[model samples]
Target: MKLIKLDAIDSTNDFLKALSSQEELDNFTVVTAENQTKGKGQMGAKWESESGKNLIMSILVKDFLYDNEQVFNMSVIVSLAVIETLKSLDIPGLSIKWPNDIMSDNKKIGGILIENTIKSDGRIVSVIGLGLNVNQINFGHLQQASSLKVICNVEFDKDSLSFLIIEKIKEKIEFWETNSALFWKEYFNSLFRRGIPTPFKNLYNQNFMGIIKGVSSVGKIQILLEDDSVSEFDIKQIQMLY
Candidate 1:
């Protein structure tokens, strides 16, 4: 539970990864920053945040995973952890967009980027980076973005929120260690737009209609096609048009 607070950084995930390489870090070591110069999201998208307005942090989880292929399991654990934290705050319409985007009322409020490294000795280390919009209001042209303050009409304490989320993550990690089936069930139930026909786009920007069934075992989205065929698509191959 070692915590390091920073005024700003290039990316908390990068910083923690570098730190872990140089020295032995305690499990659940956390690094939080007020701002990120090169904040990033899934698939190399830029994550922009207002200074001192959000939860920008990365956590180091050492040797908890059995192998590198279980990254999606880690994703599920962390995603549910964030959702539980937000739900405890009474945030309405909380759902997980596939691959781990936190959504409320169909707008994204937070996101997760997990970076895993397998050491030479086969120890799997994960650096989980989370960005949650808290008090910041303006998103410029990003229409599908909103924050806790915007959704609930009340300001939030970033420190308290960060602590709660981290604690929830720790709890979920413990829970998932033995109750993987139950946690996966929770994930499918909390999935956004499940069982409803939705528009999706392919890599070439072609639109199609599909219903999100659930995620595949390999971490891809499972969509029921228009012709009654269920297909799995990687995150890079398809984009949900909500």
Candidate 2:
């Protein structure tokens, strides 16, 4: 694995993409920045933070998945890797929220963003971006946010922590290649509020209560409505009010 540490950058993903276009990209390469001027999140939301106080990195991988449906499973892998890494560091109450948010005591500690590039030969390239709160103790206006320093009551070395996560990801990737089904099963078991009644909103902005009933093979969220009817929803089809 190659590590490129930057004092400051626009976004690690964008930097990696530029390298890919220039044929300078390598598999298992990691790009870490002291700050991201324009970090992005799911649905194009801005990822906000102060420079040099958090973990902002992007990892590149080639041929991550052959089937499109398997793409969502990447979140499972990444989330598990993060949770496991944190636990190994003695970070208690660390768990993965649905779809790839790291939660420490029901508060967000980190997030994952995975994107892909399709090559002409039909191979897929994956760019996995992770933002982990390390040294930051407060988020000012962002509620429900916490960092390792605040949670653990001690400062952390972001560089060492980043390498630990990378090692965990490599191990998880190996596990995924041989036991994908098992991984999915475990993921559903660890899913946030699985099989528990929760309020959710459908795409049409209809709000209702339902129980999360595991995810499908394709990563669609399955919910059992109040009337005992089971329904599945694709990404962006439903939003859970957690």
Candidate 3:
């Protein structure tokens, strides 16, 4: 639980990755920035956050127990941890969108990006980056993005919330070692719009209605289409439409 706080950084994940490569780091070593100049999202999108107004951080998970193939399980663990942390804060309508977007009332509030380093023998060291909109009140034209202040009308202490989230993640990792099946079940049940008819557009720009049937163990999204057939898609292969 070693914490490193920076006034600003290009990206916390990048900094942690570089540090880990340079020397052995403790598990759950945290790096946080007050202003992330180049915060990243899934698919290389830019994560916008007002300076010093939100949580922009990365946690290094050294000696990660899971191998490369169980990366999705790692996602589930992290997402669940964030969700539980938000719940403890009394944030309403919290749900985890597919992959790792944290949503509340169907709007985006946070996201996670996991980068893994694999040893030749197949062990893993994971760098888990998370961005949670905390006290920021404006998203400019980003209508789908909201923050804890916007949603709950209350400002939160960014540092306090960040530490709580890290603790929750550690708890999840410990629980996962003994009860992985339970974790998977809870992850699916916490999915946003799970089992609900939703609109999506494929890579070809074809729009259709489908029910999110849950993600595969490998992290592919499974959808039950209008034709009563099932299809699995990788990230960006299918887009969820609001």
Runs of candidate 2 with Cα error greater than 4 angstroms are none
The residue ranges of model 1 lying beyond 4 angstroms of the native Cα positions read none
Task: Report lDDT (CA) for all predictions.
Answer: 0.92, 0.84, 0.91
Whole-model lDDT for model 2 versus the true structure? 0.84
- lDDT minimum window of 10 residues, candidate 2: 61-70
Per-residue accuracy of model 1 over 1-242 as CA lDDT, tens digit each = 99999999999999999999999999999999999999989999999999999999999997678775677998889999999989999999999999899999789999999999989888899999999999999999999999999999999999998899889888888777689889999999999999988999998999999999988766889999999999999878999988
Give one digit per residue, the lDDT tens place, for model 3 in 1-242.
79999999999999999998898888899999999999998899899899999999999986546565688888999999999999999999999999999999878999999988886677788999999999999899999999999988998999889888888888888777788889999999999999999999999999999999988989999999988999999997988998
The worst-scoring run of ten residues by lDDT in candidate 3 lies at 62-71
The digit string of per-residue lDDT tens for model 2 on 70-146 reads: 78877888888888788888887876666777888777889888988877777778899999999887798888889
* Ranking, lDDT, top scorer first: 1, 3, 2
Tell me how candidate 1 scores on lDDT.
Answer: 0.92
Give candidate 1's total backbone clashes.
0
**Candidate 3 local distance difference test against the native:** 0.91
Q: Which residue pairs clash in candidate 2?
A: none
